[model samples]
Target chain A: MDNLNIGRHISGQFNEDLENVINHVMHMGGLVEKQLSDSLKAVYENDKELAQKVLASDYKINNLEVSIDDECTRIIAKRQPAAGDLRLIMAVIKTIADLERIGDEAEKIAQVALESFDSKQQDLLMNLDNLGRAVLQLLQQTLDAFTRMDVDAAIELHKADKNIDRNYDALMRQLMTYMMEDPRSIPSVMSVIWSARAIERIGDRCQNVCEYIIYFVKGKVVRHTSPDDM
Target chain B: MDNLNIGRHISGQFNEDLENVINHVMHMGGLVEKQLSDSLKAVYENDKELAQKVLASDYKINNLEVSIDDECTRIIAKRQPAAGDLRLIMAVIKTIADLERIGDEAEKIAQVALESFDSKQQDLLMNLDNLGRAVLQLLQQTLDAFTRMDVDAAIELHKADKNIDRNYDALMRQLMTYMMEDPRSIPSVMSVIWSARAIERIGDRCQNVCEYIIYFVKGKVVRHTSPDDM
Candidate 1:
């Protein structure tokens, strides 16, 4: 919020309104980050209770998205902000949608923990733990970049998403090999594959948030210009 | 666009600006729909050339999304639309992002066509064709509802997303059986699995567009209230 630096308007209410929306967005980001981290922990430690916590807590993120969306609409209607203030509001709206989906993907990841894996398949989850932790770090850094509105940090972390994808691809190959070796293991291994996919998607969402960070700060749509270059 | 029934302001330019944005959104929606349809066709006919066309033409949708997004930002800044007009702008902004992702998913589905399928696996692609066509119909209906801003159609089509999910789940179980029965077919079957996942995601994105339609018309966030219920 401090980084926004757009609160020196003649109208005091307008300044407070903008500040509140930004603060609420940060609060929502914190909750989403927590949900993602807890879901990974649930998968890593095989804690059904923690997995249940991840499931039960998702409503919090969904509710925050709705209320914040309402606040954005109200701000635009009441304040009619222009330029940087407008961009920030736009970015907040887009970011919350991505954040909400990230929470959902985390929930998908947590579901894997509820399905019991055999001792051998436990090692597969261990590999998934590695990929999950990598995605978690990407989310953390992306959140920090978003908080500070740091374009350089956003670009740097955007590159880090490639690492997460590489890890996910490697893990997927390993799982396929395991499934082929023992067709009986396909059911359980399939869950691990799906979790890996979820973790990879979380990385993609982080990459999207990073683009929004750059867009808000630089007023440039940096989506296709990334190393993905698409 | 006509169903919006706004844009009768004292400022003549405001009316034109609002109309232009809506028209561009519909145009973009058309391009996205074609991409989804062509991708499915490429898969069904096993036409790599058509699949390649789907891939190459994706940039049109991406570029339209960015341009239309800029138009929304410009309209908001210049016209300061409130109430329904404001909701329409917000809907356009959100709908374009979902539309772009749908393009990406369609591109993913089309990628499956580039790889050759065996005679046995060709039957699986036929099943995928059925699911893909069903999802294509959902997209068409969702786009129609969005253009008209019809709340009832949006709700009805939102329910239709459940049917898409049901088809996807059934197709997935069948694919898993195919893979289990013949483990060596994992690599090719894996592509179909990913393609199926992409098709299902397009349905989810259509469902999202439907919610946006309802949000624009009713000025309510109808996400968590769906039968999927978040």
Candidate 2:
């Protein structure tokens, strides 16, 4: 399709500008999730090439984020959408940001992997891999809820965050024990700890996305509380 | 002066539109610093009234952030700024986001303080107070650096983050020891630990702001690097 035709199609098919915004967010989400998965795999396999690919792709993600953000601004300026649509558009804009940061975090993890490519921290790296997988699962679920506008799924993701937190706490303790047992493992273990913390934070970002989804759908500030509690 | 005259005067007085964006960002930096200060101080003192004040003022901070971001976007679109101006505008935008999140983190801490207002976790609360002070100091310094466009200050703030990290690790250990020592303290200590972690993460956010400042001024990436090393 030509640019003019494409613009007309988007403007005509979508009842509100929010539909276009949501579509762009979903597109960004898909790319970011792929970045997360590939980066984690690269770290696990110690594949520098894959890590490089993730890093290179970050530029594209950054560009996409800027474009989506600009579009959100335009819509907010022109349409002044309200209620559910307004919240959803705002949430999509906010979630796109969180997703972009998640991509950056993945790139940072990949960079760390590249740094310690030949290190003897295989066990710690595997722990990070596990944490990354948990984060990926959370992001996938969060995105699903966002796309479907499923408040229940969003709530579930928020509760599931505690599980990631518990796992992260365990990982920290295990690393602390390793550091305490052998001072030699302190530096290497510290890097692994940072990566695990990064992954855990990515999980938190996903939860934030889920929270936004719930807010978009329900108009409730259900932060720092469980869905069941709400 | 009339509105048009005032606009023309300022437009002619400033060297570049980037300066206006940077100045607006500094305004946001000032606001966020106040928010962080009051929010943490309210937590430290168990001042429910002050916490309420922080909560109420947060909307203003959020609004200021939106304005700053809108200003940055306008500058970017109008001037298509490149090189230093581009990086600076981008940095300001990112810093606004970080500052906004820091405000949210501080609000979260204040919420916990409000929740445990009548609780019996004095020691844990005291540790949280210490952590809050440390994190606030780092945030203040980082914001000051951005205000002054001082790369050295930003670097110094980066080095100081290690202290916050060390404090966080120590706090985690203390919280875990408390939890193990007295199961009864688990709930309260856990809450305090989470607040402390949030505060430390706020310090990390300040570090990110500092990194962005460096990127703005020097067009360099300084993540995962220390001031001394750099």
Candidate number with greatest lDDT: 1
Question: What's the TM-score of each model vs. the native?
Answer: 0.97, 0.59
Please give the C-alpha DockQ score of model 1. Answer: 0.76
Error of 1 at A37 (Å): 1.3
- The residue-level lDDT of candidate 2 at B104 comes to 84
Per-residue error for A26 in candidate 1, Å, reads: 1.4
Candidate 2 local lDDT, A106-208, one digit each (tens) = 8877776676633556887888888889889888888888788788777878889889999999988787666556554555565676678779889889887
Proportion of true inter-chain contacts also present in candidate 2: 0.00
i-RMSD of model 1 (Å, 1 decimal)? 0.7
Worst-scoring 10-residue span by lDDT in model 1 chain A: A221-230
What global local distance difference test value does model 1 have? Answer: 0.88
Q: Report how far residue B146 has shifted in candidate 1, in Å.
A: 1.2
For all candidates, state DockQ relative to the true structure: 0.76, 0.08
Tell me the spans in candidate 2 whose CA falls farther than 4 Å from its real position.
A1-16, A117-120, A226-228, B1-97, B103-230
In angstroms, how far off is B47's CA in candidate 1?
A: 1.2
Candidate 2 lDDT, B1-230, residue by residue in tens: 01111133235533455556666677777777787788778777878898888888777767777677656555544544445555665677678878888888878787765766334567677777888888887877787777777887878888888898998889887766665565545456556766886788798898888888777677666654546667
Per-residue lDDT over B90-152 for candidate 1, one digit per residue giving the tens place of the 0 to 100 score: 989999999999999999999999998889999999999999999989888888888788888
* Per-candidate clash tally: 0, 0
